[model samples]
Target: MRSPSIAAAASTAVLMTLASASRGQTTGGFSLDRFEPAPAGDAFFGVPSPAAPGHLAPRVHAMLDYAHRPIHSSGDSPIDLVSSQALLRLGASLALWDRLLLSLDAPLAVAQGGDDPGIPGVAFTELTAPELGDLRFGARLRVLGRDAGPLQLGIGGYLFAPTGTPAQYTGDEEPRGAFHASLGGRLGTARSSLGFLWSASGGVELGGGPNRPQQLTFGAAAGALLGGDLLQLGAEAYGAAPLGGDLLLSSTPVQREEAGLNAELLLGAKLRVLGGLTFGAAVGPGLTNAIGTPSVRAVGMIGWAPLPQPDSAERAPAVAAGDKDDDGIDDALDACPDVKGDPSPDPAMDGCPPADRDGDTVRDIDDACPTTPGARSADVTRSGCPDDRDGDGFHDGIDACLDVPGSSSDDPRKVGCPADADDDGIVDASDACPKVKGTASRDPKQNGCPDDPDGDGVRGAADACPNERGRPDPDPAQNGCPRFVRVHADEITTSKPVQFIVYGKTRAQTVAPISDDLLREVRDAIQQNPDIELVEVQGHTDDSGSEEYNLRLSQERAEAVLSWLVAAGVPREKLVARGYGFERPLGDNRVKTGRQKNRRVQFMIIKRKGAAVQR
Candidate 1:
C-alpha cells in the first residue's frame, strides 16, 4: 500500500516532463533539477598544477544563460497548460590544497506561464520564478589525476538550497531542495558525472501528508579542441529517473512518474589570451525532456580560469642528452674527446699509432733500434720500442765497438775495438811495439819503426854513436870526447853494466822489418855484462797496418830481444822486454829523421829498484 501523495508526486513529474517535450527548440546548460549538474564541466579547464614546483590558484567563472521549458498537456491534465523558464548561472573554483577543490554554483531562474483558463488571470499575474534555484555548493577531492593525462577524474558532493517554487508550482514536483552524491571521471577532452539525489519536501502529499522521492541522474560530455588544446567543442547528455513519487496532474491524479533527458552542445576555447590566464566560452542548445520527447534548449556561458604552473620534470631529460663525458662532447662525434686521457705517445703525432721508419712490428717513432726490426716496448726515448746492439748491456750509441759484444757495466776498456797503446801515432794493429813507447819512422803498414842505437833512450838521429849501445851517447862537442869503441866479450864483462840496443827494418817499403845489426849488437852487449842483474828491453815501431797487427809486430820484436839475450848466455830472468807499438816516440813522425828515431829499441841495466826508466 503506497501513499497517495507519493503516487500523485510521480504523476506530476510525468506532466512536467511531457510539457517540456510539447514545446520545441530550447537550449540551456544542464541544471540540477533537469540533469546531473556536474562539478562544473568547465572546472576541468583548470586542472591542478602539474606535479611540478608550483600551485594551481583560485579561479572564477561567470555565465549568463536562459532556457525555455515549454509544456503541453491533455485537456484533463492536472498541470497548467504550459510554462516557460529562463536561467542564469555563476560559479567559481577555489583550490583548498594540492588535492582538494571547493566550488560554488549560483543560478537565477525566471518563469512565464502559458495561457490556461483553469487558473484565473494566470497570464496577467507577475510570476517571479520562486527566487530561481538555490545556490549549489560542492567540493571535489582529487583522488588520482595528477599524472593521469587528459582523463581527469574526481568525486564530490553537492547541495542545492531550497529556492525553487514548491507551493505555487503544483505541476513542478521535486523542484527544490536536493542533495546529490556524485562520482565523476573524465576522458581526453571530456568529462562525466553520475549522481544519486535525495529529493526532500517537493512531491505531493501522501495519505493526507507530504511525500518525497529519490532520483538518479547520469551526465556525460565529450569534446575536442579545434586548435591545439585551445579551442573546444563539446556535447553533453543527461538522464534522470524519479524513484519514490509522482506528481498529481488531472483530477485523476495522472500517473506522472517518468524519466527526463537533456543535452547541451558547447563551444569553448582555452586561451593563454594573456599570461597565466585561461579564458573559455561555451554556447549550446540544451535538449530537455529528451528521453522520449527530446526538446532543444539554448545556453551561452563564458568562463575564465588560471593556467597551471609549468612542470620542472619535463626539462630534466633534455639536459642529460647534451653532454656525454659530462665534459660536453656529445659522444657520437667526439674525436679524441677524452680530455683527461694520458699524455700522448708523441707530442707531435697526437695520441695515435706512431710512425714506423723500418717495416718492423715496432713503430719507428718508438723503436730504439729504428733501423733494425725489434719488439714493441715502452722505451719512450726509442719511441716506445727496444733495441739491442752488440748483444751486450749497452745500446749501439754507447757501445764503442758496436759490432763486437761488449759490456758497458763490466770491462769497457778491455772489450772495445783495440787502439794504439804507445804515442807513436800508430794504432796497435800496425805498430811493431804495440805496448811499448816507439816512433813513427818506419812503414806504418807492418812494423812501425826500428830500434834505438844508443841505450841512452835516444835513437840514431839524436845519438852520437847511432850504432852502439850502453853509453852516454850525447853530442860529442857538448859532453863526450870518446870515439866508437869495438869491444870484445872481455871488455864488456858481466862484472860491469852494459847497454843493449835493437832496431827494426823492413824488406817491403810498406812492411817494416827488424834491424839485423841492431839485434846482434844488443845480444853481444848482454853477454859481456854479468853484473847486469836487471835488463829492460823495449821494442818500438811506427803506425802501420791495423792497430791490432802493429801491436803483434811490436810484441814479436821485443820477444826477439829476449831470445837473443838467452842465446848469449844471459839469464832470461835478468831481462824484462815489452812492446810499445807506436806510442812513445823520440821525434816528430812527419820527417825521415823522426821516422829513423821511432824505429829503435833500447835496453838498460837496473842498478837499483828505483832506476830511471829509459826509452
Candidate 2:
C-alpha cells in the first residue's frame, strides 16, 4: 500500500485533470461559488457598505474547509476517489474611493486522501492521476459597482494560480499551474457570477497517455443573502464543456465527451458574537458532481471585518433640509417650496397671497392694486379696487360724483360730495342759495343769503334803509325801501356798523340812565344804514368838578354806549370811542340836573365794503 503522502499526491493529480477540463466547475463550499456575498458597494440592503468608508472597505477574512470526494463510474471504466483538501484565506478589500475595489485570496491547504486499494468501498485498485498538493493564490479586481436604474452591476475578473504537485500518471502531462477569470453582478437581493476558464491537463504517454490539451469552458453562478447580511443561504450550479472536445488522440475513434455539472447548497452566517470578531460558518453539500465526483464540503470562517470607517462616502446626502417635495424649500418660510414660485420680487408674497391695501374687504389677488388703501365704501374698479380715483385723497364710493371733483358743497349731483358753494363753506341745501356766493351768517333765515331788503334803485342787500338813503325814514317802503327786508348780521358777515345815544332830562333832578335796551335801539338804527362802516362814541360831562376828573368820567360814559354794540355780536373793529369833555356839552353845567343831562355818550356811523349790511 502507498503511504498517505503518495496516496494524496496521486489522488490530487487525478482530481486536477478533471478540475481543469471542467474549469467552471462549482465546488461544494468555495470553488467559484461567489462567496463575496455582495459586491463591495451595492445597495442590496441600503447604500452598499454603509460600513465602507468612502466606499473603502478594509477587511480581513479566513476560511478553513474539508472535502471528501466519492468516486463512481459507468461500466467498463475504473474510478478512484481519494482526496481531502483544506484551504485558508486572508485578504483585505481596498475599496478605492467609490468606483473600484481590489481583493486578494491566498489559500493554503493540507490534502491527504488517495486510493491504495485494500480499503472497503474504495473505487480504485491503483492511483494513476496527478493530484494537487500545494498552495494556491487568486486575486479579484472589481471594475464597476454603481446604480443602474434599479440594479447594481459589478464587473470584475478573477485569476487563480497553482503551486502544487503536477505529475501523477505513469505518463503524466497535466500542467502543475493554472489560471481562471470571471465576472459578476447583483440586482436587488439576487447576485450572479460568471466565469470562463482555460487550462492544460494531461501528461506523458506510457500506453499512449491522454493528451493534456488546452481547453476553454464557460459557467454561470448566482446567490443571495437571506435574513440580514449576517446570515446568508444560497445555492449555485455550474457546468462547462470544453471549447475543443479533442482532449486526447486514441488510435480508435471512440466518441469522447468532456463536460461537467456541478451544484452546491451553501449555508453561512456572520456572527458578530464577540465584539469585532466575526464568527462565520459555511457548509455545502454537493448536489450534482464537482468534476464528476460526489463530494461534501464544509467551511468554517472567523473574521474581523474591522468596524466601518466614519467619514464614509460623504454624508448619505442630507434628506435635503426643508425640502417638501423632497425638493429643498423651507415651508415655514417657503413661498413655493414645492412648486417653482413666481420669479417676481418678494419671494414670500410672490408664492403666497398678497395683502389688500383698501379696506374693501378684498384680497390682493382679486384686488388689482392690493396696496390700495382706500375706504370701505369707496368706489372701486371692476376688480373691487381703487386708485385714488378722484385724487382728492378720498376713494370713490362715499365720494359722491366719483368722476367730478367737488369742494365741500351740498349739491350731490354737480358737486362730487357737496362743495361749500358760495365759498361760504355752507352747502346749497343748508344755504338759502348755496350756488350764489355769500359769506357765513348767524341769522337763521339769512345764514348764507344776501341781505337785500328794499326794491329801490339801491339793492337792500347793501342799502342802509335799503329803500331810503336819507336820514330817519320811518316808513322805509315809501322811503325807497320795501316794508319787509332780509338782514344778515352774523359776526362773520356784517359789513358796516353804527352807534347812537340820546340824552334825556330828569324831572325834579331825578334822572333814569339809558338802559341796555335803549342802547341797543340806537345801535340798530345805525346798523340799518348801509353807509355806516364803523361807529364812534363821544361823551360829555358837566364842568362841576376838576377838569382831569371830569374828562376821565366822560370817557367812561362814552364807553358804555360802545359796549352795547359789541355785546350785540357786532365786530369791535366797527366801533370807535373818545371823550368830549364838558367843553362840548350841550346842556349847561351850572345846575346839578343840567350837568347830569350833559354827561352823556353819543355815536356816529362809518361806511365800509363787504362789511355793508342792509335793512
Candidate 3:
C-alpha cells in the first residue's frame, strides 16, 4: 500500500463520474483528503503555539508530505481503496504587532493514485479526481499571554475554497469554514536543558451537504530540540469527527460507513541546519479506519526563512599582532626589541627592565633570592615580598588547597582546583593514590586508597611490612614486632633461655634471685591466652643428683616457679607444679651442655578452656 498509478485513479474517477450522473444527487460520503499543512509559527508539528514567528516581517514557507493509503480497506478486494498521494503545500503569512497573523496556503497533488477502475471506494467519489486541493485563507490572533508560557492562548479561523476534486480525494465539493483556538506552552531554549514546546487545537468545521459533512477537529503536538538546536523530535495527534447524519449508514454498496472521519497520530523528527533551513519527517498509525483515515501514515517537511545574522561590529582581516621580543609590547614600540621586558611609562625604558628571568616582580639586579621567587622583605637577605612555597603559580598566601599543586580555573570559586584523574571525587590534591580509583579514608596518607591487606591499618605504598601484619614503627627493620617471644600451641617458646639463681647443697633454684626479660614474656604469653585453663610448671634435675634428693629438689623448684608466676599476675589456679627429675631432657646428661639442658625448666599446656589449642 504505497503509491497507486495515475491511470488507475483517473480511470476510476471517470467511472465514478458516470455512476454519480446516473444517481443524480450528491452521493453519500468518502471524498476530500483530511490532511492540512500547519501554518508558520507551529509549536510542534501541526499544533500552533501562541507565538507569532514573523511578527516583524513576512515569512513564506513550503511543506511537502506523502500520505500512504489514507483511504484503505481491510477487505482484500483493493488493498488501497483510495489514493496514496504526494502533496506540496505552499503558504505565506504576515504577523502584525506580535498578535495577529494572516496566511494563505495552497496545496496540490503532484502525484496520486487510488483503487483500479471498479473498487467500492471509487464509486463513493461521485466526481472526477482533480490534481488540486482546497485553497486555505487563515488568520489568528493571540488573545492572552505576552510570551510563551504554560497558559498561552490563540484564536483563529480558516476559509477553504472549493478548488479541489472530491473524486480525487483531495477536498470537499463545496466551500467550508472553521473556527479554532489553541493553547500552548514553551519552556527553555534547548532540549538538553529539558527545553520543550507543546500546543493543542480544537475547532468546528461548518456547513455540510450530502458529499461533505460538518465536523469537529482537534489535535495536539509536543516536541523538544536536542543536540543543541540541530535536532528536533516531536509527536502530533489530530482527528475529525463527522457530525449529524454523516455517521449514519447510507444507501450504497460501500458497506455503510462511507462518511469520512480523520484521526491519525504521527511521530516526527526535524533537523535544523544552514541557519534558517529545517528538514523533517514523520510517521504513525491512523487511530480508526474512517473513510479518509489510513492504517498508517508518514510525512516529511522542510521550511526556510531569512537568517537573522548578527550585526557586524569589528570585522577586520585576521592579522597577527607584531611582538618581536615576545613581551606584552609590540616591536614597533619596544625600546629593546630583542629582549623581553616589563611595561614602563618612560619611552626610553619601555621594553627594558632589570631582567627578572623567572618573571617574579623582584628585578634580578636587586633580587636577594634571584632563582627562588620571593617578595620584598625588610631583611636584606630576603626581600619583603612573599615567597612561593608550593610553586603552584599562586603564592602560599592564595594557594587554597595548599597540600597539593593545582591548575588555575576560569571559575573563581575553584581558582586552583586540582584534577581527579581517577574520577573518584577525591582530587589529586589530597588523594594518596591519585591515578587509581579508590575510596576516602581518615588517614591522610591513605586517603583515596585501596584496602590494607595485612590488617595493620597501614595502607598504600607506605607500608614497609606489607606481607606481614605489624604495627607502625619508626624503625623499618623491627616493624613493631618482638624479636624473641612466640606463643606455640602447647607452650610459650623463647629464643633466649630463662635465667634463675641456683643455691643450696641440693642444687635448689629460685626465680626471685635472677630475672630475665624472657621470663616476663612467658608471663605475658600465659596472660594473653586466657583460654589456657591450666599450665603445668615442670622442673627437671641432672643424673648427678641422687634420685630421692633430686626429685625433692625438682618439686621445690617447680613450686617456687608457680609462686613467682602468681606474683607476676598469672592466676594461681591456672598453674600446677610438678617435678620429674631427669625423666625428660632435651640432651643427654653425659656432657656438660646436656647437664645444663637437663636442669632447665619448661612449661606445658595441660588443659584449655574449650578445645586443645592448635599451632
Model 2: ten consecutive residues of lowest lDDT = 199-208
Best-fitting candidate, scored by TM-score: 3
Rank by TM-score, highest first.
Answer: 3, 1, 2
Candidate that would win on lDDT = 3
CA lDDT of every candidate: 0.43, 0.41, 0.64
Over 4 Å off, model 2: 1-56, 70-80, 118-155, 167-228, 244-279, 287-292, 304-615
Supply every candidate's count of residue pairs whose N, Cα or C atoms clash at under 3 angstroms: 92, 44, 9
lDDT of 2 by residue, 221-268 (tens): 343433223343333333333333222211122112332433444544
* Candidate 1 wrong stretches, greater than 4 Å: 1-37, 40-56, 74-83, 110-113, 117-126, 129-132, 147-152, 167-212, 248-272, 275-294, 308-615
TM-score of each: 0.37, 0.34, 0.46
Candidate 3, residue 284: how far the Cα is off, in Å: 1.1
* Model 1 poorest 10 in a row by lDDT: 195-204
**RMSD per prediction, one decimal?**
44.3, 44.5, 29.8
In model 3, which regions exceed 4 Å deviation? 1-18, 22-31, 76-79, 117-130, 190-193, 247-261, 305-615
Instruction: Give me the overall lDDT of model 3.
Output: 0.64
lDDT tens per residue, model 3, 464-560: 4332344677775444333455555687555655555543233223563444455666687687667888888888888875888888878888887
Give the C-alpha miss distance for residue 206 in model 1, angstroms.
Answer: 18
CA lDDT for candidate 2: 0.41
